[model samples]
Target: MRSPVLGAAALFAVVVLSLATASHGALQYGFYKGKCGTKDVETIIQGVVRQRFFSDTKIVAALLRMQFHDCFVRGCDASILLDGPSTEKTALPNFSVFGYDLIDRAKAAVEAACPGVVSCADIIIAATRDAVALAGGLKYQVQLGRRDGMISQASLVNLPAPTITVPQSIQTFRAKGLSTSDMVLLLGGHTVGITRCSVIKDRLYNFRGTGKPDPTLNPNFLQLLRSFACPKIGGDNNMVFLDDPSSSLKVDNSFYKQLLQNKGVLQIDQALALDPATKPIVQQLAANPTQFLTQFNQAMVKLGAVQVLTGTQGQIRKNCRRTN
Candidate 1:
């Protein structure tokens, strides 16, 4: 028979282990089944997205990008939804990002239905899945159970810049626990968004301070972009499609096709086709839209899983814009 002292010590160890696991709970697909009155959170979110932003492709694109930006900076904790004079939204890289109002609207709907149960973080993940599906992209599953973070600092927003080289982009994504292939696949998210002229002005007129356009960009495409995208030096806020003109509103492989043809709009985008390490993936994605979408959906799932705060580690903020 075991000693009474040994039995008590073993019991203490088991309790401690259980507490640790609960405090770091793993995420699941149906995280809020019984806790809320709904077994289908995806359908509920899809209804809201379709009713409000139906066929409004820009808003759909914004919603998708919102989740990407949120995951990149702070592990998809909904820190991007917070507002302040010095929050992540005020950061230079995120200054022009839209869709906070949409996120707030989605959160309000979720709160009304299941007050104090669903998190703003999980709402973002669900909303993004619905948005992409509504945009004619492949539907994929998103694991939930994320918790809202209490902190959002502009100083901590460190997204990759538009002008970064392929090697630099790889390093940036790798620092976030993503691989080079993941970097290429996640970038396909740009397929449905717009790019501001300010982001490409240097490449258009002053590549490396030479006072000349970037030699890598196709000359004919350069003339076309100059004709409309930036007629003047200070058209900083003017915007253009990031993908081929025909499919800017559709999430497809055309962005890679443009790069292969030397029509890529951003320096970082063109660098993918120009570098040996990433060129093959870019070429493969260009020729295989189905494969691109498949890998993109997979990469996004991985993106959402980064450094997440789960279990009892964080709070479910009643207001997404402020910590509860």
Candidate 2:
């Protein structure tokens, strides 16, 4: 597990998060402050996430990806948390989604301190923010005040596939009210995750049914990838870092830098540097590390507001998996 953020980084993490307002001023920083009566809600959440982060640094990637999966389909609601046969969590896209248990633990901690005070949706956001900072990304604050969603259906899952082209992904994100720039910054989270060979096997073995590797893959990287993952005969599920090996587990601009080298693991990943429309943005982000982290922070906040339920619009679930 990645060690706990320490030294100046921990202090920087505590630096007062900026107050951000949602449409009509629904959400703001510290939304849970004092709501639990002397129990710092975010701090409690941070403690739980920090513990989880210590034991399983993978939670950093899991929680970050969980936020995207939960938000994109149902607008930042915890609909993805509902328990049932046909629920969103049962979808193929969410089959490998982790951190549900982590979120449950965090919610239980909050409930023990102050029952029904914090929203599962807010927990997801806060936990993700904490995870990002632990993984060496920016320590940005997320706006709160969201309520749990009332619906979650596998049929409702429409997340973009890993093979989606740049144009297709641009439209997909646009449909969620995210701009092209936001999509690029958000995808930057690839800086600290992994994808199995099973997910990209076709690109390595057969390109467009031609029985050849993806033309976009650099010849050298192709050999490196085959050696690292996707062996000729077995272990189809072997893990491969999304970013290059040097900075795979750390959140940095290296993912973008690798893209410039034609070393992206996912098709959409490499496409960012190869596509005319997005290549410039990729180059810009690759060159300026600070800008990448800063915009990535803002993009996450934007993602949290997609189609949220606030005020009395949705009930606060005593259990995130079911309605109260």
Candidate 3:
């Protein structure tokens, strides 16, 4: 009864529809099986962090702090952002309009795209990585389908290593199941940001005193540092590099190279360079920027794998900055 041409066209349409359905189904199943979990988490977190933080240096600094603390204890748990004792208490405000705004935006987008599918914890983790990418860091695909976490423990909030001693920092990371290689890689996040005097005053003044200072710092840079951070007054900390200024924003091995030259900012940054075990990896990362980017992407994927609540477990908060 049907014409041959019409029949063929109908068959083609059916085939196309079938393929699309199959693809969508595969994506859904893959997500449930934890295929794209890392990528989804990183994208969400990075997007939110970028939207929330106004200052690039502050955003990068907070991200580095988050990575250091998260990977230091159990994994990248987004716990470092919480306020409590045992935390570093960096100059960045915990609950700011900037922070919450971006988070809320991310949540809203995710909810619209895949309602009640992804978790806040996953979102936070993904958003941070995305922020790094936005800042010219390397890009890698991550997985998705993580759920939100209902439990927000006070203990988890205050678990960052406040002081920056090499031994203590190493101990902190080791406790978190991170190796020295991971520590060096994670610390590379300092490539793009500034440190406040309040955060490292003790390191600059108490650790080295006025005259000697950290021998790694450039003398001219040190003079600028004293003017900006040393007076103990509240002001912007001078920009420190994980890499050369030209490629500082890029997530690469230059950070390790900087460390090799004693150009690291914090004690933790310098210690990685001197440690024989970590020095090789640092040099490797410096030499092969692509390798560092690959590692960074993989680490981000791992970081996004923390506990998450999904599939009707947690409500989509209208405001990510505040608990609903």
Candidate 4:
């Protein structure tokens, strides 16, 4: 049999190749070296994230989701952090995305130590890395130098819907220059966080208006889910853990294992196992938690680098919620 070590090395190669093609040249490991004061910016961001994680463990997942939301809509420019009645944060899909206040707090700490040095966009990325680390995920380095965008338009927030199919999800990721493997790996972020029963109720009842649960769902698990206190309609805020309830707060490869068992909470997640293109990758991740974590880190690094504003493209906003 082929060695698992070799398998992982090969997978890492694929990740590097996918990232090398798209990463901008401006991002570097120590982009803030001389700009920030003696206090390392990454250290300040991590300190705040770690402290917040103690008060609310869910903040880790929220920060991760926040990074994804920001990157997907406007290329990781802190656009999702913008404040206004019509900004991206006010978009319907982003209604539940929290952690903006946490970002602000971390930004304030950074500004006190090194004013006008680090960008809120980079702070968001650093906070994401720290949050993942505190939540049991393996650590990975993030390239810096991303500048904050000056605009946040709700009309531009075009992320894929929860009901989308695997093909549709693949296309959505591809539009952002991510590959099939990247899509599967990044979607594993679902391993953390909670979802509202209302967001997933349609899959459990009246799937496609047929008054039947989705056949893809494991029957036993479906019955268990149906028994939850969530109402049949309009209980959008009734939340359920995303992963195995026992380890919902931890970040690992349990999501792939859940997908293998037809316990995925979202239609797109179940579609990962049902679709041939993504199924094998899902299976591999389920079997090798280390490989899953490794790829997840790589995918996140690549995600942070997507269409990022760099150099003279965007400015460092004093306030994340405004352009300044």
Candidate 5:
């Protein structure tokens, strides 16, 4: 355990993708260092995340997923936090996204110390980074200075589907200026989360309309899912861990290991291990859990910098749910 943990911590040093990590023009490692006067804004956010995590262990996954969904659409902005009849929060892909109240809580705490100083966009990134550390993930320095976006429309949401192919996922992430390696590392976030049974039943019962389980699914794993996690009918919304049950709650390479075993609950998860283009990366990460743990931090850092609004491009919202 000690060796593996140390390895993951060193994973960040192994990556040299300067292009993906160049980040936005105005973003910096500690962009908010002196902005809050006497208070450390990130420290404030971390405290909120720690408290919520103690009460809701599942908040780990929710916040992690929140980062992906929020960043993927509209470029790491708090656009996903905007509230309206037609905001991105109302989008179909974001229907299951949680950790909203957690962000709100963190934003409120920061606002109390420095009114209208911290952007909700930065809060989302900071809070999610804190949650990842609390959930056994390597804590990475999240770039700050991201301003909250003024627009968030459901029509603007185009999150990739659960059934997306490995190639398609690579393209999708590439469109956002992320690399294939980044795609593999980012998808690896699923190592700590669970998917609703409704999201994976198609692979279990009628894969490709063949009226049979997906051929790649491990027989034992398939039986386990059908028995209790997901059934042929009903139980559409039941929770099922994305990784093996024993280690689903941990942030490690278990998800990639499970992929090697044909136990991936989602098509995309299994596809990484089986796809020609991504299999090597998956094999490397799976064989070296530490790499998955460590590089994941760098991948997330790159994620936080995606097409972000900086300087005077956006406003600092007093309330994350609306434009200020």
Candidate 6:
């Protein structure tokens, strides 16, 4: 009964509304805001960090391993946090320090507070965020209810790169459904951590000469770096360092600023600053740390939503480092 133009307009409006609803649903199911509150999970996470289950260095390393795995495959499933000889042999970083001890402490605490309710995977994720907060960034709540992946496929550890190019890193993150904006926001986590020369020595010394130095780094900081350790062609572990000055103990957004200036420690770290697709996001976060934190929390929520094998899919391993 209506005119052709009116009918077409009505159909177009319906399509637009449907797409908008779908988008909103994706964000909500994948990235809804949640409260950390005084929940037992939060308490457990804080308790572990406070008690020092592993040294600050170890915790950060574990978090990086987890982030790498999560972004590589599906989402941040706590597979990297699993412990055991089988898992250890297959681990990406070869089971550096994160083990069942920390997971046991958290499990015990959570059990006492609220038994059999929280997932070990969720604890690891929350604890990582707490660790970030301790290092120097704003604290945000991570959503809970993630289940453990029963089958920890050690072979999957091969996915992450010890050193990655900026474009490759962007492609990896994009493959996981993250946008360039999400990639930069997430890398902001580097703002509070440390990187050993073992990771970036090649980028710093081999390709580029020590005399020139990367112009992005603060001249004074670069001078300090040069004094620490010299790079080599191949070494087990050498002593060279780049540290986040904001709060080495907490996680925050200042890392992006470092990237903007070319102080990013690794190839991938610096790449975020240089990439055309991601540079603007990095700049925006560098300009507004608080907003970055807020968005980072949201991204964490989404990352935690990847194909989780919860409920019956997986069981709580007696030891988090190994499959029981």
lDDT of each: 0.80, 0.85, 0.52, 0.86, 0.85, 0.57
Q: What residue runs in model 4 are displaced by over 4 Å at the alpha carbon?
A: 1-8, 11-23
Look at candidate 5 and tell me the lDDT of residue 14: 46
How many residue-pair clashes does candidate 5 contain? 1
Worst ten in a row by lDDT for model 3: 20-29
Q: Which ten residues in a row are the worst by lDDT in model 2?
A: 1-10
Candidate 5 per-residue lDDT, tens place, 247-290, comes to 87778888889999998888998998898888878888889866
Residue pairs that clash (backbone atoms under 3 angstroms), model 2? none
Winner on lDDT between 1 and 4 is 4
In candidate 1 the C-alpha lDDT for residue 245 amounts to 70
lDDT winner: 4
Clashes of each: 0, 0, 33, 0, 1, 16
RMSD of each predicted structure: 10.4, 6.0, 12.7, 3.0, 4.0, 8.4
For candidate 3, give the lDDT of residue 298: 49
lDDT of 4 by residue, 192-243 (tens): 8788888888889889999999999999889888887356756667888878
How much lDDT does candidate 5 score? 0.85
Give the Cα RMSD of candidate 6: 8.4
TM-score of structure candidate 5: 0.93
Ranking by TM-score: 4, 5, 2, 1, 6, 3
Off by over 4 Å in 2: 1-25
